[model samples]
Each structure stands twice: as structure tokens, then as C-alpha cells.
Target: MGFWIYMLAMDLLIPLIMTGFGWYFSGRAPRKINPVFGYRTAMSMKNQDTWEFAHRHSGRIWKICGLVLLPVTVVPMLFVIGGDEGTVGTVGGIVCGVQLAVLIGSIFPTERALRKNFDKEGNRRKDGQG
Candidate 1:
């Protein structure tokens, strides 16, 4: 139980911080651009050429953090569930729950947050990129 909490603290905190950083450093604040469009705009190929100004690296960084956290998240969960159910379950559940919050809430939000404030470029918005 105690061990699970400790592991959860380590694995979950990374993603939580990553997501927080993503929001903290939001590019331009897309008050006008729609959410979906914002994502597309940031990830498109047209946004090339040393343009680390917008949500490119930040988005990628947040995503990378999430990706890394995805695997790390399993370790604590296994420890929690594999241990004794009576006592360990309670602690494990709590810790896993914390990581779950970051996984569910922050994960997608961070992705969306990446494109929260940016506009499309050029006449053709579609660059065949998904």
C-alpha cells in the first residue's frame, strides 16, 4: 500500500507537471480559432521551418510526457492491485486514482491546449496530415 502511493507519486507527478506546463505556456490564446482547428493548425506540415514559436514543440513535449507516463503509470497500478486487497487495495486505489485523473483529464486537455490559440495558414488548410 505504502509502496503503491510512493510509485504513484513519482509516475503521476511527471505527467501532471507536463500538462500544467503545457497550459502555463499556451502559445497565443486562440480566442477566435476553434479548438479542433487549433490542433490541426499546429500539427500541420505548413507550420514548418524553425517555427518553434507556436504549439509545435510544446504540444509534442506534452504528448511525449503523456506517452512516457503511460507506461510508467502501469507500474504503480500493478503494485497496488497485486498486493493484499484488504489494506493495499485502499492505498493503491487512491494512488492509481490520482494518476488516472492526470491520464483522463490532463492527457486530452493538454493535447487540446496545444492548439488553443493559433490560426490556419495559407489558402489550403488541409495538408493531408492527421
Candidate 2:
């Protein structure tokens, strides 16, 4: 039980971090563009506009995914409360894997949006120009 609880806590880390950062980024992403931090990508780094757009776009996705994953993560653990260590560990691992998939997967939509809104030169497209 103790180990199960510990695993639960550890498994919760990703969702919590995602949610927290999502909330922060959605509202107040870093003000400046730099190579060191924030959502860095070729398209997103094209300019300040792309940088801000990527953050807000990705942040919104992360916030929603994190909120949905919270219950998804917790419900499975409820079933394994008294299970063996191996069972608990396996379930926990699967949940964390999903979280990681979601975290990495968010990049797609953000990149797509960037491509749609901005050209290779980072210039915002006019309506229907995409």
C-alpha cells in the first residue's frame, strides 16, 4: 500500500506539472524569445509572433489534456489499490507512459497551427493565404 501510494504520487507528477505550466503559459508565457527556454521550435522560433502563438496554442492543449488525464490516471490506480507491487507498478507505468505521449504529442497541433498561420519567413498570412 505504501509503495502504491508512492507510485501514485510519482505518476501524478507529469499531469500536475503539465497543468501548472499550461496554465502559466496560456496566460503569461515568457516575454522574450530566446534559445534557452519556452517552446522552442523552428517554426515557433521564426519570430516573436510565432513564439507567442506556439506557447498559447500548446499551453491550451496541455491544460485541457492534463485536466482530462487527471481522472484517467486516478481511476486506474483506484482499481489497483490493494494489488501486488508488480500490478501497481505496471499500471502506474502505463499511465505515466500515456502522459508522456500526450506531452510529446501536443507538439503536432501547435506546429500545424504555426504552419497554417505563418509562412516560412515567419510572416503572418492573409486570410485564405494558408
Candidate 3:
């Protein structure tokens, strides 16, 4: 029971935090060099424009994915709280898997956006690229 509760809390809390971070940092991410925060991907860090664009794009993705995931985490909790350890573990694993999927899924769109908006040299595409 206690373990289930912890698992549920973690599933809910992690996505909530991610959502908050995405929302807050999307608009407020720094343009300068920083070790932490913001979307720090190879394509995104190509330049300031790419960096900012990726962060903003990823932020929206993360926010949406996190929001969608939050309610989902609760469903497993309801089942786990009443079910046996096996069920709890299965539910917890599923929740984690979903969360991982969401995180990984969010990156694809952001990377695609980066590729669309920027050229191979990381410069903004002005003509037909966008």
C-alpha cells in the first residue's frame, strides 16, 4: 500500500513538474550560455535562434504531453491502491512507460520543427524552407 502510494505520487509529481518547467521556461529561457535549464540538444544549441526556437517548441510539446499524462497517472493509482502487489507493479511500470514515451515523443516534433526552421548550417530558413 505504502509503496503503491509512493509510486502514484511519483508518477503524478514528475509530469506535473515537467509541465511546469515547460510552461515557465518556454518564454523565459535564457539566450546566453548556461549549464542547466532550457532545451539543450545538439541541433537546438547550434545557435541562439535555434536554441530559443527549440526550447520554445519543446516547451509547448512538454506542456501538452505533461498535461495529458497527469490524468493518466491517476488511473493507474486508483487500480494500484486496491490491487495486489503484482498489479501495483504492473500499473506503475505502465505509467513509467507512458511517461517515457511522452518524453521521447515530445522530442521528435521539436527536432522536426528545428529542421524545418533552420538550415543545415543552423541558419534560419527564409524562402521556402519554412
Q: What is the C-alpha lDDT of each candidate?
A: 0.50, 0.90, 0.81
- State the TM-score for model 1: 0.35
Q: After superposition, how far is residue 25 of candidate 2 from its true place, in Å?
A: 0.9
Instruction: Put down candidate 3 lDDT per residue, 15-126, tens digits, no spaces.
Output: 9977997897677667674557677778888888888888788888878888888888997688658678788888888888889888887888888888888987799988
Between candidates 1 and 3, the TM-score winner:
3
lDDT of 1 by residue, 30-119 (tens): 334344533333433244321333344455556565656656666657655546645565655565566566545544543343334333
Cα lDDT, model 1, residue 13: 69
Model 3 spans with C-alpha error above 4 angstroms: 128-130
For model 1, the local distance difference test gives 0.50
Clashes of each: 1, 0, 0
Per-residue error at 5 for model 3, in Å? 1.1
Q: Can you write out model 2's per-residue Cα lDDT over 14-129, one digit (the tens) per residue?
A: 88988988998898668898889798999988888888988999889989988988998999999999999999999999999999999999999888888889989999998625
